[model samples]
Target: MKNNRYLLLVLLMAVIFFSGCERILDTEGISRITSFPTFQMQGEEIVTVVKGGTFTDPGVTTVEGYPVTSSITGSAYIVPGKTQPTDVVYTSGAVDTNVPGIYIITYSSTNPDGFSGTTTRTVFVLDQQPDPAVDLSGSYASGTSPGATITKVADGVFYSSNAWGGGSTVVIPAYLICTDGVNVNVPQQESTVRIFGHGTVAANGTLNLLMSRPTFGPPPLIDLVKDWVKAN
Candidate 1:
């Protein structure tokens, strides 16, 4: 009977002392904690990380924030909580920060009581490529149907009437200004400019045409005058 009572006291004391035993209380191997690592974020590509057998405590992850959907490169990371973090520190990796110009990265951590400390990593973001350039300042000319081709006429030869429905105007070097692939421009209101050879020649023979209002000039001229009449 006395031994039973004595055993009860010892067992009671044992319950109190063993209740605080750390190894018995610790279910996970703390030594197995993973160290947080850094990553390079690209513009907006998929980014990922692997844990070296460490379990993710549901409400805990890396300090970069939430588990990022691998499709969008963002400021996401597997942040270790107040507990020590573990995972091989990464180098030579890339991810997309998704910003237009440039960006940076740093490291930090959270505590068990919801507080945080920090370590750091860095990342760089770059710009996308630009479109190609084109040049179209040269010369081109279209005739009648707006699709008509004006043949280069020889000296003393006559050019036929085009969709303009009148006799052709001999294009002289002086009267010619510019010709886009579609339309043509000439010196403003030149009545009879000579079709000197392709270069600057003097006194080349010319073709004549009836000029209309705004003072009759040659045909094939783009008349830019707009005379607006207001009623009194």
Candidate 2:
């Protein structure tokens, strides 16, 4: 009877010791990853530019950690002007210059171990004219007449509204090309008669337009000097 008790105790102790050893071995097999691949932006958080200006993409940097068995790959996407987060598309860092608003650029990177990271940057495209001296792009109001709107379509190129008080309500397309900081040459895109106009853009966003009409037999006749004040 005493031998049987001693054998039972020995078996129990062996089982306990083996269980303890197994626990320690399992713990030793597991490892805690202290570092991971991280993605970060290299430059300023906000990039500002005028409309029709080139945008330089400040790329991302990936910090590789231990166990670099795989390489890190990155992609960029743009959240279009004042759009929702779900409205994003992968891009090659090309931004639309026509749209003037806030754009969000998201960059993400992934590693072979399924570890990933992401960062974002903002780009602001302003509608304001780039040259401080030439502020010709804005809405203008002249007396009780229908207001005219002028917007910068490209660098130094502006689109202007049609003249008021015409029998036809059709809008005549007109474009102004700024040769100098103050001088502007208007070229009529479409018109039955040859139209010639010139203007000067003031510092306070005012336009002084001197238009000419076709004379039947002599030099072009000068029309009234129309002063357009920039609308608030």
Candidate 3:
């Protein structure tokens, strides 16, 4: 009977030891569950904007599935393909509005628990539209002497001559700014020198130009106004 009692005591001790070990493992698993938080994005993953335009942010949110409650903060940044990104704001400005290309926007969030998450979105900045009111693809005459000739070399680009007088020829790059197609303004720049001019086109095919050259002093060194009419 004593031998049987000793055998039963050994079995009971083995069961008790295993039960304590299981309890310890269960507590450790629960501790790990409450230690980390969760995060994710909530809106559009892709968007597009025109060149020289503004961008709108969709936004993001965090999800904490565990019993713990923590506040999460996020930030968005830009990664350009070729040129450096500029004018970066909080959630927008992932793409450079002045340059046309594909860009990536990374959104990252972090909590007090040292846990973090990241998501990404793609942005495409398209080329700007051409203005119909300002057409610089023909010949023009200002006063007398030698007339100016303008030819359309490419989209939104023009090659011209007689910009600085003396019958000298130069390439003139122009950009058209139109408000409601009726009011048009053409800003032109000389490629060789730092001479710039802006002109307003009237309904009678007359272009009134105000030209200027920047100087190291307070005011510009050269400022002249001239009128040009379209030549047949």
Candidate 4:
């Protein structure tokens, strides 16, 4: 039991440590910061741009918002219109996009004044089925890892990208939510599901869904659950 507890703790710590990274971009006036999306699909890297951080650098005289306690007497701003602002980077665990569908990302941080803020983002893995038919098995059920590309059956113009596995099964947990920006809610038909392929997944195998039909937000999820089933 002790060993198990330690192992669980280690796993928890590992999870926290691997959760990506963040930083503050200080442009003279300390303007804005944007975080980009990173993922692997069909042996290719896919990145989407994101806008975040409406932070104003309190001032050169202040730390974030509060006044700097001590003067560095050093640490000049990087460039004229910009300087490197102090920030915490969360460069740890990369998100798993091996399975297709929607993913939710939520983050919360507290300011020195005890104020806390939270945010989220959505990642939608493409399904080769451009003209997605109403199939119960799943969507995007096929693909090769290293990653691969397929024309969406549901949408003729769009292309679906995916990662591969050795035709193993995948299962995700009962995730309550993903990102908060978009609004949506669709009840899950079941508690969990098994996914086939790394990137493309169809609705055939058992799967997970939200409680309400989400017209917007999070893209829906089941990858972690699918992977969980495989490892166990």
Candidate 5:
């Protein structure tokens, strides 16, 4: 029984430690565990550029491994006690501001131990500016989720307080863009989670959002809808 318990404990530790690692450990021992590298975008996840406008990348910062205790710093496999920021190389989707569409830019970095992390940014090229007369800024709540606050950033661009509905414990925000006053869309972006959605605003100020979140997992939701009622 004790041997089985020990084996189970070891398995659990391995699962937790190597959860996001891209490569197998170099050695059999646990002395050299590699923490996954992460990339942080320097600017907003979503940006809009007018037709024939020039778009400049805001760039990103990459870090290898989480900070560990001083005792573990001596391990050659582990990054020292401090976080190591590295220059990351990125691959991006083409962006032509002259065309009205969306573009995606992805940034990726690999740690010394071979673990890699990736993040992405989205850009929208508009033929014309959003209509300012239509504002959907307010608190919206659904039946399954709590509530999300929508704040207007640009004329028709909005930022939600929470990405996956309102009741999610992780408060990742999603951007909603409305070219017209009625139709709304959530661009494809990563807020620690990847999300793509679209919906509309009703005459009575109700928001009906259909979110497609592969990160949330499961049978691949296609028709899932969240009817958000605007609360003053």
Candidate 6:
């Protein structure tokens, strides 16, 4: 038992020595404390532009006192930073009003401390008004959600009250655009929830919708398909 105790003590000392050395080596990256700058949108995060109409960017600003690029210094706003930000790049996605699609604009800034911050905006370009004959505004009931309201803003534009099919801790509306009254799309938009999906409506007025959790890449964490029937 005396020999076993000595061996155990040696092993414990070795572990402690190695752990201390490892921590010392790992401190190289975190030797200096730094913080990433945050972004504040000047206008709405989601902008809707009418097809064939001119589109303009409302731009963004810095909230946590971050410097901005010189090009946008006059247009873009900033709070103020300890040091001017370097290597600032404002990349804006192309927006063609003649075509209907979603565009993304991104901005990135790096502070003198080598920390970087980035943000993006989403723009939707499509005709809000649809054919007068098309109307899908009604209460839809599905297995997961019951009595989800679909409010009509225009002939083709509708807002779904329950995008997650109910049971969500926070309820947010999702935009459903159906131009021809057959095909449907849930654009990537920010609300209490970020929604992205597509579905179709049958002749019998049955809605076959599929939704994915908010994600920046393919293969979302949560994928769900809900078939909603119009409540009589």
Best-to-worst ranking by TM-score: 5, 6, 2, 3, 4, 1
lDDT of 4 by residue, 1-232 (tens): 9999999999998776665322222234356453332221221122221222121112122124332221111111012222112211112232333432333343344455455444343333322322333222123332122222333222211222322222333222221111221221121212233112121222332223112212212553232222101111
| lDDT per residue (tens digit) for residues 17-134 in model 1 | 8876855668556555543423333332211122122211112235445232221112222122211111212222234334321112333354443454433322222122211221
Q: Candidate 3 clashing pairs?
A: none
**Candidate 6 global TM-score:** 0.48
Higher-lDDT candidate among 2 and 6? 6
Residues 1-232 of candidate 5: C-alpha lDDT, one tens digit per residue: 9999999999998988886463445533657667676666678987877768998888777555332211100001111122121211112445666654456666666776766666767677654678879888988776657578989877667878765663444555777777678887665555666565667899988877676565554655443576778886
Against the reference, the lDDT scores of all candidates come to 0.27, 0.55, 0.49, 0.27, 0.63, 0.63
Better of 1 and 5 by lDDT: 5
> Per-candidate TM vs. native?
0.17, 0.40, 0.36, 0.21, 0.53, 0.48
Q: Could you say which candidate leads in TM-score? A: 5
Could you tell me the lDDT of residue 176 within candidate 4? 17
Better of 3 and 5 by TM-score: 5
List runs of model 5 lying over 4 Å from the truth. Answer: 1-47, 51-93, 98-123, 166-172
Candidate 6's displacement at residue 89, Å, is 18
- Candidate 5: C-alpha lDDT: 0.63
Worst 10 residues of 4 by lDDT: 70-79
lDDT measured at residue 1 in model 5 versus the true structure, 0 to 100: 100
* Backbone clash total, candidate 5: 0
